[model samples]
Target: MPTSNEAVKLQHDAGAAPTAAEAVRAIDGIAPTTGTARQVADGVWWIRLPVAAGPGHVNVYALQDRDGIVLVDTGTNAPQTLQALTEALCILEPNHGTIRRVVVTHHHPDHIGLAGWFAERGAEIVATRGTLAVAHRMLHDKTLSRTPEEIDFAVLAGMKDLELAAFIRRPKRRYADGVAMLPNATSVIADGETLQIGKRCWTAIVGNGHAVDHLTLCSNDGLAITGDQILPGMSTNLNVPADQPDLDPISAWRDTCRRIGEHIDERSVCLPGHHTPFTGIAIRSRQMAASQEAVVSRLLEHLQRPRTAIDCLAAIYRRTLSLAERAFLFPEAVGYMNHLANRGEIVGLRRGKTMVWQKQRRPRGDTIRREASPAISRPYNFSSEVDESR
Candidate 1:
């Protein structure tokens, strides 16, 4: 018989995968309806809309201005998503002409896909320098592109090619940095700067990790447009792309989360880019911190078994992932693993063309105990078992 502590540990150690119902429940709860807007504070509204064949919807925020509305984050470039946003805006302001500016929290397609459409209608677009560059790269640079062949290589390198292709093809148009060339636009907003939109003022705080130069807009009305920085349901993916192989997203993301937590008050309502508005900034910040910490813990556990980064990724993701998903998974797993390796909790060594990780001998027994147990080895099968059973 196991002690209560041991039982709890076993339960935790079991690594029970989330059922499809649980996943759907988690996602469905965050996004109650497509294109529905929820008022979180005075003159502030959160909106969710479906994107192209993705896990969940993308969230955008609208701040009512005395003259017009300041929109933060446009949905994906799909016609339906655009139509949903248009309808929601019409409901909020009645007169769509009142939308003064469109500020993108980041350059991700889900956040900026419809920015050009809004810009065509006279909303100013803004983002960080790095974000703007990446957005341009995403749109214009097709030469150095990661084609299906590259995806297949990634698959052989340990990823699912089909999913990777789906992820890559989602973005429609990418915008260049700075204010878009819209006739009725104002200017590009940058870090440590403030902009007055509608009846409120917002400050742009730029940080990196999830995306290069991700911006979180904080308003005096106790509202923060967190974009994908802090999601309510799932952890945000942090990766080091083969194109930008030198990027260290884990450190950047950790620092960004800490900064956001420090600046915003605990009671502030977060208008994320993918979920309903929620309160308790401090609590969410702690949760975000813990989530990343959990990833590090998972990485360390895999290291004890002397697995390569590819092996660790399979262990962490635990299913046949789409090529796109595998692309997202591998770099994220390696990044967190590298972060822990840098902290001396684990060690990574290059064996031929692969990087294998292992635990470092630490002084404290508690430190060893703090590291999570190894993952249960399993084959990759991305299909939802719960969905099949149902």
Candidate 2:
């Protein structure tokens, strides 16, 4: 793959193609797919597949197993994605294009949508029990993610009546819209289960938040397959669903951050779901925790006066919001607001028919907690057993 960085380096320095060494240092910095697989490690290859709609491609990894290739994640389903998948498979696993097994990290549309695509072709699908359960329900009922409860929640967050009416009339986004088809069956993977892929033994370190029971694979040989758990460039969406009003995703996400820093070595390379894979995970994990906490603190200060979750959107993101962005933005804003309420920093009271968050005390604006030890520990002791449990 010709990295955008590689081209710029060519003009600045001598003509030097992207090297495995450079890719090892900063995988995300490496140019995306040049219509072929880029070797990130000895037996691991990186493949970038186009999304139906997004800024760039979704990075999928293919590991060499004894019998055939073991895929970490599948890009979203569609003819366009299938075309990209076939082209990459032709280059990486040309022997018989044999994908012996497909391991999914979570139940996100992009990661789980194409599980059936490979399963239909005989690859055994692997994912958490919760993920499979949700997939089945989504296949049965398409409009589950966005219901009247969501509209009501949005109104509680302060979305105007006109926007709410327009949104309900055009509730086009649904769970099934992202997932092409559900695999009839999946060989479920539990937390702390070791999987032998290629020459390494990878263990499934399941953590809560960011899609409950999200599995991040930590290999014995200092390699971690972090599916959206530990992305390089951006933060994962930690939102609370309208139905599960009690779930604290930020706290759950913090526990996952601790697990990554504790289980995975600092020097180990993390092959993430999006962006480039990178090393130095210990530092990155702490940075992520601090950044998230700062976002929470910022919101709490904004809540000194009563504010709806919708009103808090501007406090977090100062720019204009898009319809697609609001789908995520509202939930995450509510999640942070809920975290504050849970911490006794804010109070959520019924303002007329909807809910609004107000500060419990004078806002402790931007007071970074100082301690002898680390900032994050075991996180809040709540687990999203799944939507059913919620």
Question: Each prediction's TM-score against the native?
Answer: 0.74, 0.83
| Candidate 2 TM-score, C-alpha based | 0.83
TM-score, predicted candidate 1 vs. hidden true structure: 0.74
| Error of model 1, residue 296, in angstroms | 2.4
lDDT of 2 by residue, 188-268 (tens): 899888898867898888876678678898888888888877665456676676777646677777677667666677578
**Cα-based RMSD of the predictions, in order?**
10.5, 8.5
- Which has the greatest TM-score? 2
Candidate 2 accuracy as lDDT: 0.69
Tell me the whole-model lDDT of each prediction, alpha carbons only.
Answer: 0.60, 0.69
